[model samples]
Target: MSDTAQAAPPDAGAPPRTGHWKLIGPGIVAAATGVGAGDLVATLIAGSRFGYALLWAAVVGCIVKIALAEGSARYHLATGSTILDGWRSLGRWTSWYFGIYILIWGFVYGATAMSATALPLAALFPFLPLWAWAMIAGLVSAAFVALNRYEVFETVMKLLIGVMFVIVVAVAIMVLPNVGAALRGLIPTVPAGSAIYTLGLIGGVGGTITMAAYGYWVNAKGWRSPAWMGIMRLDNRVAYAVTGIFVVAMLIIGAELLYTAQIALTEGDRGLLDLREVLADRFGPTVATIFLVGFFATAMSSILGVWQGVSLLFADFVRNIRGGTESREELTTSPAFRFYLFWLTIPPMALLAFGRPFGLVVVYGALGAFFMPFLAITLIWLLNSSRVPKEWRNGWLSNTLLGGAALLFIVLSIAEIARLITG
Candidate 1:
């Protein structure tokens, strides 16, 4: 967090339903955003390859994210400053880096997210090609955010999350996983030849630049005082708890369904499609369609989350640069916010048609890989600094978690970069 100027209170109309479980909005948004199409594929792959071998690692991943998110939302409410404002206090360079990062990151991710979300929809409605469905997905997601206030956006996200949860749990139960093996998988042993994946699973669960957007969401949700801290903590835990279960459910499906059959899935988003085929063959099209709907929810939630959350960062960035103040309402409706929403949805449509360029993919991969480490490092600095109130500063446990996250991500970043370069 930066020693940035404190923010003013949000416009005085909305009620603060502090301490209520119903007030758990932003954490849900962040969790849904974190567990996107890529994460789903990764979790599924983990299960197929090592039937619950890394379940303990998944548990660790959730704990680390809980710490990071707790620190982030804590900073927001404690300081009443957006994460952008905090970063700016470090130096103008932080703003410049984020500005460029969001531009490139959003461009590439918009296309990928749209395509991923559209896959099941396209399969369900093959009258249109994948690209056509991608376009529709992008447009529909954009319109959803543009139309909804934060409250409505959160409500819709919760609804989708319910659908996602029910389907994933249903699939896991259908697979009839061995209860004994799964319990032992929770014993924290890392099998040989699985170190890289173990680390990746542990470090990558429910994370991305959306981790940073957490603070913005907290701010947008009217949880702006230290008094709201306990509520934020509860909300953060519940969010990642949902994420933890979703990952585990997919793992169970992979372990029991695919592992027994000795199935190998393709890499990336396409793997989910392959799984859909397998599911349809084994369980019928109706069951497969239900799972696909869950897949759509996973991908589309990210689209909506980035649409609302990252654009909030853009609004804050512009506000800091111009040395002006804007209420939360103004930021949401600001041209900067809406423009990035358009940036994320529209220009990427071209990538859907022409296909992504090699260089663009490399850039996106490199930037995306580095963000966790960047966030981990900056968060440790911010939470320990004078910018946040002393009482709200990180305790030793938080420090240990953030430090471990930074170190873990540094290793993951190097591995990802090496893979991109060799390919």
Candidate 2:
């Protein structure tokens, strides 16, 4: 098919449209996938250290992600091609970077996701050790992704986010947050010594490699052409709006419950467990238990999302590498997909038992740091070039947002690499 012929929607003259709420799927999956336990913990730390001072950062982070996700989906719809295809058009180097990145990143991230998911479960049900719980979480996520198709996976993600939303917001409300302070937080101001936290909150809210997987989710949701552009944009915005709320709610919890009391949390996912104890002391066992459930929902959703979404990405990579033309649906069931599913589940469990290797951790950190910038720069290149239809090319607003995102990620990447080297 001619380029224009392939790019044109089946119904060429359809009216412009907006998304109906019922059509929201890929965005939820993307949002759920992106906002993992680490993002929440970072926001929590920001709130604890500088109560509501960095709230604007969370809001801006969401906006940045919305731009990134929207750009990704727009490419998919405008060109009737995968993001991997767009990358391939850039150069063979894109393939090499992605191939190496996905392999190393997935192996490390698998353990991280499993460990994050296991934390709350271990806290809530202490009968099982953390490693065992991590293993179970990994296996269960693998099984769910293996058995279900995109529709089922999306439904489950929606349900998980629902549980996450209600419980987290409820906890925030229970804290009786300082409304005036929160409102004041809308004004951007960086307090002394808060530069790192401010940068992290702004650049790390929902940023992840999964942001690049967004187009795959959009494609899996059966949106193949530009006719779905309006809905896609709506879906993307709504998803990040929800993410903003989650981050804000966690910040409120930290501000009201921890900051006021001068209680310091242990770092990492364990910090959440510390918050659980605080909740139990301040409220009761029931409230602490509820927060743990929300924590599990948040972490488990990430596991499910990565297992499914990134597998789709890896499968697409394999298909493109082989010069195969498998439909998105077929890619889900393809051996490449299952192999990644296993790659993300089984091999990583070893990390749980033996501890993450120092060298592997450094490489994972380096690659993970660079991925967001890579994605943002590549999207700008792909969307602005002839690879995309002229009518569908990014406007000034999209370009500005994406350009800013690229700059922000580049800074964060340098910081991460510097940290790795210094340590």
Best by lDDT: 2
Clashing pairs in 2: none
lDDT of 2 by residue, 47-97 (tens): 888999999988998999999999998999999888999999899999999
After superposition, candidate 1 runs with Cα above 4 Å error: 1-19
| Worst window of 10 by summed lDDT in candidate 2 | 1-10
Lowest lDDT 10-residue stretch of candidate 1: 1-10
Please give, for residues 1-423, the per-residue lDDT of candidate 1 as tens digits: 111222323533444555388678789989988888788788888888889888888899999999888988888888977787888898998888888788999999899989998888888888999998999988998887777667778888888888898889989999898999999999998888888889888888796888888987787777677888887898999999999999899899889988888899888888899999899999999988888888888888888888888888888888888888776547766778779989999999999989999999998889888888888888999999999989999999999999999999999999999999999
**TM-score per candidate:** 0.95, 0.95
Let me know the TM-score candidate 2 reaches against the reference structure: 0.95
Query: Candidate 1: lDDT of 222?
Result: 72
Q: How large is the C-alpha RMSD of every model relative to the true structure?
A: 4.0, 4.3
